[model samples]
Target: MRTNKQVYRSGPAATKFAQAVKVGDALYVSGQVGMDESGHIPADLAAQMQLAYVNLEQVLAQFDASMAHIVDEVFFVTDMQDFMSDAAAIYAARQAVYGAEPAVCHSLLGVSALALPALKIEIKCVACVAHESESHRAKASR
Candidate 1:
Protein backbone atom coordinates (compact mmCIF):
# COMPACT_ATOMS: atom_id res chain seq x y z
CA MET A 1 0.00 0.00 0.00
CA ARG A 2 1.19 3.52 -0.82
CA THR A 3 1.01 6.29 1.76
CA ASN A 4 0.71 9.91 0.79
CA LYS A 5 3.52 12.08 2.09
CA GLN A 6 5.57 15.20 1.40
CA VAL A 7 9.29 15.70 2.00
CA TYR A 8 11.60 18.71 2.30
CA ARG A 9 15.33 18.59 1.71
CA SER A 10 18.14 20.77 2.99
CA GLY A 11 21.77 20.26 4.02
CA PRO A 12 23.90 18.80 1.21
CA ALA A 13 20.73 18.65 -0.97
CA ALA A 14 22.03 15.30 -2.21
CA THR A 15 21.84 13.44 1.07
CA LYS A 16 19.78 10.24 1.16
CA PHE A 17 17.53 11.53 3.92
CA ALA A 18 15.07 14.40 3.89
CA GLN A 19 14.98 17.16 6.49
CA ALA A 20 11.33 16.64 7.19
CA VAL A 21 8.47 14.44 6.01
CA LYS A 22 4.77 15.21 6.22
CA VAL A 23 2.17 12.44 6.27
CA GLY A 24 -1.45 13.54 6.40
CA ASP A 25 -1.50 16.07 9.26
CA ALA A 26 1.63 14.86 10.98
CA LEU A 27 5.16 15.99 10.20
CA TYR A 28 8.36 14.23 11.20
CA VAL A 29 11.36 16.54 11.25
CA SER A 30 14.80 15.02 11.04
CA GLY A 31 17.43 15.76 13.65
CA GLN A 32 18.75 19.29 13.17
CA VAL A 33 22.28 20.17 14.18
CA GLY A 34 23.97 23.45 15.12
CA MET A 35 25.77 23.80 11.83
CA ASP A 36 24.53 26.72 9.77
CA GLU A 37 24.30 26.98 5.99
CA SER A 38 27.89 28.19 6.00
CA GLY A 39 28.76 25.11 8.14
CA HIS A 40 29.66 27.05 11.28
CA ILE A 41 29.34 25.17 14.55
CA PRO A 42 29.35 27.17 17.77
CA ALA A 43 31.25 25.85 20.76
CA ASP A 44 28.74 26.62 23.47
CA LEU A 45 26.00 24.07 24.07
CA ALA A 46 23.22 26.63 24.53
CA ALA A 47 24.35 28.44 21.43
CA GLN A 48 24.35 25.15 19.57
CA MET A 49 20.87 24.35 20.79
CA GLN A 50 19.60 27.74 19.59
CA LEU A 51 21.12 27.27 16.16
CA ALA A 52 19.65 23.77 15.89
CA TYR A 53 16.22 25.17 16.67
CA VAL A 54 16.74 27.76 13.98
CA ASN A 55 17.51 25.01 11.50
CA LEU A 56 14.48 23.05 12.65
CA GLU A 57 12.29 26.14 12.22
CA GLN A 58 13.52 26.58 8.67
CA VAL A 59 12.48 23.03 7.84
CA LEU A 60 9.12 23.50 9.48
CA ALA A 61 8.49 26.63 7.41
CA GLN A 62 8.77 24.55 4.22
CA PHE A 63 5.56 22.78 5.27
CA ASP A 64 3.86 26.02 6.41
CA ALA A 65 4.25 24.92 10.02
CA SER A 66 5.92 26.54 13.01
CA MET A 67 7.12 25.75 16.51
CA ALA A 68 3.51 26.08 17.59
CA HIS A 69 2.70 23.06 15.51
CA ILE A 70 5.29 20.88 17.15
CA VAL A 71 3.79 18.24 19.44
CA ASP A 72 6.90 16.30 20.33
CA GLU A 73 10.67 16.59 20.24
CA VAL A 74 13.83 14.67 21.12
CA PHE A 75 17.16 16.23 21.98
CA PHE A 76 20.36 14.30 21.44
CA VAL A 77 23.34 15.76 23.20
CA THR A 78 26.93 14.65 23.15
CA ASP A 79 27.65 15.88 26.68
CA MET A 80 24.91 15.45 29.22
CA GLN A 81 27.16 16.63 32.02
CA ASP A 82 27.83 19.87 30.25
CA PHE A 83 24.17 20.19 29.35
CA MET A 84 23.04 19.66 32.92
CA SER A 85 25.73 21.98 34.22
CA ASP A 86 24.01 24.82 32.39
CA ALA A 87 20.44 23.60 32.34
CA ALA A 88 19.04 27.00 33.28
CA ALA A 89 20.73 28.82 30.42
CA ILE A 90 19.84 26.08 27.97
CA TYR A 91 16.20 26.00 29.00
CA ALA A 92 16.03 29.77 29.13
CA ALA A 93 17.24 29.90 25.56
CA ARG A 94 14.63 27.34 24.62
CA GLN A 95 11.87 29.22 26.39
CA ALA A 96 12.86 32.37 24.58
CA VAL A 97 12.61 30.60 21.24
CA TYR A 98 9.20 29.14 22.00
CA GLY A 99 8.10 32.47 23.51
CA ALA A 100 7.00 30.52 26.60
CA GLU A 101 7.09 27.05 28.05
CA PRO A 102 6.73 24.70 25.10
CA ALA A 103 3.48 22.81 25.25
CA VAL A 104 4.89 19.60 23.84
CA CYS A 105 6.29 16.25 24.86
CA HIS A 106 10.06 15.97 24.79
CA SER A 107 13.06 13.84 25.70
CA LEU A 108 16.76 14.37 26.20
CA LEU A 109 19.34 11.70 25.53
CA GLY A 110 23.10 11.65 25.74
CA VAL A 111 24.87 10.52 22.60
CA SER A 112 28.48 9.70 21.92
CA ALA A 113 28.67 11.91 18.86
CA LEU A 114 26.83 13.26 15.84
CA ALA A 115 27.46 13.31 12.10
CA LEU A 116 30.11 15.96 12.67
CA PRO A 117 32.75 15.81 15.32
CA ALA A 118 32.30 19.45 16.33
CA LEU A 119 28.56 19.10 16.78
CA LYS A 120 27.25 19.03 20.36
CA ILE A 121 23.48 18.76 19.97
CA GLU A 122 20.76 17.61 17.59
CA ILE A 123 17.03 18.13 17.92
CA LYS A 124 14.28 16.13 16.23
CA CYS A 125 10.70 17.28 16.14
CA VAL A 126 7.24 16.03 15.28
CA ALA A 127 4.48 18.48 14.33
CA CYS A 128 0.79 18.30 13.53
CA VAL A 129 -0.84 20.52 10.95
CA ALA A 130 -4.45 21.43 10.84
CA HIS A 131 -6.48 19.75 8.11
CA GLU A 132 -7.00 21.92 5.05
CA SER A 133 -10.75 22.13 5.54
CA GLU A 134 -10.32 22.87 9.20
CA SER A 135 -7.84 25.61 8.42
CA HIS A 136 -10.23 27.12 5.92
CA ARG A 137 -13.09 26.95 8.41
CA ALA A 138 -11.00 28.66 11.06
CA LYS A 139 -10.09 31.40 8.63
CA ALA A 140 -13.72 31.82 7.60
CA SER A 141 -14.82 32.17 11.19
CA ARG A 142 -12.19 34.80 11.78
Candidate 2:
Protein backbone atom coordinates (compact mmCIF):
# COMPACT_ATOMS: atom_id res chain seq x y z
CA MET A 1 0.00 0.00 0.00
CA ARG A 2 1.08 3.53 -0.68
CA THR A 3 1.40 6.04 2.09
CA ASN A 4 0.16 9.60 1.87
CA LYS A 5 3.02 12.06 2.07
CA GLN A 6 3.53 15.82 2.20
CA VAL A 7 6.48 16.99 0.16
CA TYR A 8 8.37 20.31 0.14
CA ARG A 9 10.74 21.46 -2.58
CA SER A 10 12.84 24.55 -3.21
CA GLY A 11 15.91 26.01 -4.89
CA PRO A 12 17.66 24.52 -7.93
CA ALA A 13 16.74 20.97 -7.00
CA ALA A 14 13.01 21.55 -6.80
CA THR A 15 12.35 19.51 -9.90
CA LYS A 16 15.01 16.96 -9.01
CA PHE A 17 13.48 15.76 -5.73
CA ALA A 18 11.66 17.04 -2.70
CA GLN A 19 13.83 18.57 -0.01
CA ALA A 20 11.71 16.99 2.65
CA VAL A 21 8.69 14.66 2.87
CA LYS A 22 6.36 14.13 5.80
CA VAL A 23 4.38 10.98 6.42
CA GLY A 24 2.50 10.75 9.68
CA ASP A 25 4.68 12.19 12.45
CA ALA A 26 7.95 11.67 10.64
CA LEU A 27 9.67 14.09 8.29
CA TYR A 28 12.42 12.75 6.08
CA VAL A 29 14.87 15.39 4.90
CA SER A 30 17.10 14.95 1.89
CA GLY A 31 20.84 15.44 2.13
CA GLN A 32 21.53 19.14 2.62
CA VAL A 33 24.77 20.63 1.35
CA GLY A 34 26.63 23.86 2.01
CA MET A 35 25.56 25.46 -1.26
CA ASP A 36 23.57 28.63 -0.73
CA GLU A 37 20.43 29.68 -2.59
CA SER A 38 22.57 31.31 -5.28
CA GLY A 39 24.63 28.09 -5.60
CA HIS A 40 27.74 29.38 -3.87
CA ILE A 41 29.74 26.93 -1.76
CA PRO A 42 32.40 27.81 0.78
CA ALA A 43 35.82 26.22 0.70
CA ASP A 44 36.03 25.83 4.47
CA LEU A 45 34.48 22.66 5.91
CA ALA A 46 33.13 24.41 9.02
CA ALA A 47 31.59 27.14 6.96
CA GLN A 48 30.05 24.54 4.73
CA MET A 49 28.62 22.65 7.71
CA GLN A 50 27.15 25.85 9.15
CA LEU A 51 25.48 26.67 5.84
CA ALA A 52 24.22 23.10 5.55
CA TYR A 53 22.52 23.35 8.94
CA VAL A 54 20.89 26.54 7.81
CA ASN A 55 19.60 24.74 4.74
CA LEU A 56 18.34 21.92 6.95
CA GLU A 57 16.49 24.43 9.09
CA GLN A 58 14.83 25.90 6.03
CA VAL A 59 13.63 22.48 4.93
CA LEU A 60 12.26 21.74 8.40
CA ALA A 61 10.50 25.11 8.53
CA GLN A 62 8.62 24.15 5.38
CA PHE A 63 7.05 21.33 7.41
CA ASP A 64 6.24 23.55 10.40
CA ALA A 65 9.05 21.83 12.24
CA SER A 66 12.48 22.66 13.66
CA MET A 67 15.75 21.06 14.53
CA ALA A 68 14.29 20.09 17.92
CA HIS A 69 12.04 17.70 16.08
CA ILE A 70 14.95 15.87 14.57
CA VAL A 71 15.46 12.36 15.94
CA ASP A 72 18.17 11.05 13.68
CA GLU A 73 20.82 12.31 11.30
CA VAL A 74 23.62 11.22 8.99
CA PHE A 75 26.63 13.14 7.79
CA PHE A 76 28.30 12.26 4.51
CA VAL A 77 31.73 13.76 4.07
CA THR A 78 33.90 13.58 1.00
CA ASP A 79 37.13 13.31 2.95
CA MET A 80 37.25 11.65 6.36
CA GLN A 81 40.78 12.82 7.12
CA ASP A 82 39.99 16.39 6.22
CA PHE A 83 36.71 16.21 8.08
CA MET A 84 38.37 14.90 11.23
CA SER A 85 41.06 17.53 11.01
CA ASP A 86 38.33 20.14 11.17
CA ALA A 87 35.89 18.20 13.32
CA ALA A 88 36.28 20.61 16.24
CA ALA A 89 35.35 23.65 14.20
CA ILE A 90 32.55 21.81 12.43
CA TYR A 91 31.03 20.47 15.65
CA ALA A 92 31.36 23.88 17.24
CA ALA A 93 29.39 25.34 14.36
CA ARG A 94 26.81 22.62 14.75
CA GLN A 95 26.50 23.31 18.45
CA ALA A 96 25.88 26.94 17.69
CA VAL A 97 23.18 25.94 15.22
CA TYR A 98 21.38 23.61 17.63
CA GLY A 99 21.91 25.95 20.64
CA ALA A 100 22.47 22.87 22.73
CA GLU A 101 23.71 19.34 22.50
CA PRO A 102 21.25 17.87 20.02
CA ALA A 103 19.36 14.85 21.25
CA VAL A 104 19.43 12.59 18.20
CA CYS A 105 21.00 9.53 16.71
CA HIS A 106 23.90 10.38 14.43
CA SER A 107 26.10 8.66 11.90
CA LEU A 108 29.13 9.96 10.05
CA LEU A 109 30.37 8.41 6.86
CA GLY A 110 33.13 9.17 4.40
CA VAL A 111 31.93 9.28 0.85
CA SER A 112 34.00 9.58 -2.31
CA ALA A 113 31.82 12.28 -3.75
CA LEU A 114 28.49 14.08 -3.57
CA ALA A 115 26.18 15.50 -6.23
CA LEU A 116 28.54 18.44 -6.46
CA PRO A 117 32.25 17.89 -6.19
CA ALA A 118 32.67 21.23 -4.47
CA LEU A 119 30.48 20.06 -1.62
CA LYS A 120 32.51 18.74 1.30
CA ILE A 121 29.58 17.57 3.40
CA GLU A 122 25.91 16.66 3.27
CA ILE A 123 23.59 16.30 6.20
CA LYS A 124 20.39 14.24 6.17
CA CYS A 125 17.84 14.21 8.98
CA VAL A 126 14.65 12.51 10.15
CA ALA A 127 12.34 14.44 12.41
CA CYS A 128 9.36 13.54 14.55
CA VAL A 129 6.74 16.23 14.22
CA ALA A 130 3.83 16.47 16.57
CA HIS A 131 0.38 17.17 15.24
CA GLU A 132 -0.94 20.72 15.66
CA SER A 133 -3.25 19.79 18.51
CA GLU A 134 -0.57 17.80 20.27
CA SER A 135 1.88 20.64 19.97
CA HIS A 136 -0.59 23.09 21.44
CA ARG A 137 -1.38 20.75 24.31
CA ALA A 138 2.29 20.23 25.07
CA LYS A 139 2.89 23.94 25.19
CA ALA A 140 -0.12 24.39 27.44
CA SER A 141 1.17 21.70 29.81
CA ARG A 142 4.55 23.33 29.94
- Index of the highest-TM-score prediction: 1
lDDT of 1: 0.85
Per-model lDDT? 0.85, 0.85
lDDT string for model 1 (28-96, tens) is: 999999988898999988888999999988877777788999999999999999999999989989989
Candidate 1 residue 4 C-alpha distance from true site, Å:
0.2
Once fitted onto the true fold, the runs of candidate 1 whose alpha carbons sit more than 4 angstroms away are 131-142
Per model, state how many residue pairs clash.
0, 0
Prediction RMSDs, each to the true structure: 5.5, 5.7
Please, what are the lDDT tens digits per residue for candidate 2 over residues 54-99? 9999878776788899999999999999989878877877877888
